[model samples]
Target: MSAEKWTPDHLQSAENRSLHLEQRRMQLLPVVDDLRRLAREMAAVVKEIDGIEGDIPGQAWMRARHVTKPLFKAADDIEQAIGDLGAFNTRYQRSYEELPQKRAEKRRRKALAKSGQPEAIESAPAGSGSPKKDEFEDVFDGLRQGA
Candidate 1:
């Protein structure tokens, strides 16, 4: 039923990989937090610029206005980095979560095969014992049945 064969060693390896990925994902949180802090600082800078504009004369502000655009651009860059990190973290978490499930499924299928039961039959309910079928046949039947 599973895509790959499983052994104890295979399951252990998958578990280890999952743990490693989870650890790496956890490590990313601090970096993301730091990026958030940086973004907040940038926002403060923008607010300061706003305050400066309100207090200073137009011509004088205009003379020093070049700094504001660059500050805003830096903020945008930090925000983009945070977005990218979030995306990476999501993907990492998904892969980590799926790895253990995949390994368990593989083990179940292998055990079924070893016990002389069809992997497909093992995957289905106990009462569904309509002879053993190959994966393709099972899939085709499901499609035909609109399941």
Candidate 2:
């Protein structure tokens, strides 16, 4: 239907939201990468310092590595969240695309509703109900119809 050409407002809103989430994801991706990279570099540097120093300073730098553990974990969590959002959006889009014909029919109905038209009800096929013939009809009735 031509109504399909006009995307429903809710669908458009969902599309806009998806686009925004993708943009935000893209923006955050680099930050998460940088965080992970910096965390890794810091851990390496701390380990190297601990190796160069004796017990006292080595213990402090070793503790610093532990403190950075959460940074690495948080960066990983952020990356996972971004991936999850991307996957969700992919599924959302696929679900919408999968039922194009159904969506078009719904759009048609919505357009009709907006135009103040009553939806057309589908009628059952003719003679689908109980037989019109009397149940007590003579046995010859079937033979007569066949003839």
Candidate 3:
């Protein structure tokens, strides 16, 4: 008669997982944004610093800045990781929504099983036995007996 499939411990654990995922998302969103912002700013600063003609040996630092490829790639990676997590969250939501329906279906099947209705007759396997004619033979039994 119970509609829910989850035990109290299972439900509690599911809630905990959901909360943890949300917290992870919350924490990561800002970090990803900050990384993106830093990447963008690095590009612009590199461009500006390019205007300076430097005989300076610390010019290696400038070389590090002039290329935005690695920075942008890192930002893109962060975004991709966030996107993957979001997908996981979506899947979790869908499974959570479907839990009740799945439980209801299982309960219906179980109830049907327990209701003690005769199971459907299945065809006998090959060589299991000769076909039984008694079901049809009964209808002609009286005619045969009278004759």
Question: Which is the winner by TM-score between candidate 1 and candidate 3?
Answer: 3
- Cα lDDT computed for each candidate against the true fold: 0.57, 0.70, 0.64
Q: What stretches of model 1 exceed 4 Å from their correct place?
A: 1-69, 119-147
Which residue pairs in candidate 3 collide? none
Q: How much lDDT does candidate 2 score? A: 0.70
Each candidate's TM vs. the true structure? 0.32, 0.44, 0.44
Best by TM-score: 2
Model 3 spans > 4 angstroms off: 1-12, 49-66, 92-147
Candidate 1 global Cα RMSD = 13.0
Q: Rank all candidate structures by their lDDT, best first, as comma-separated numbers.
A: 2, 3, 1
**Position 109, candidate 2: lDDT:** 66
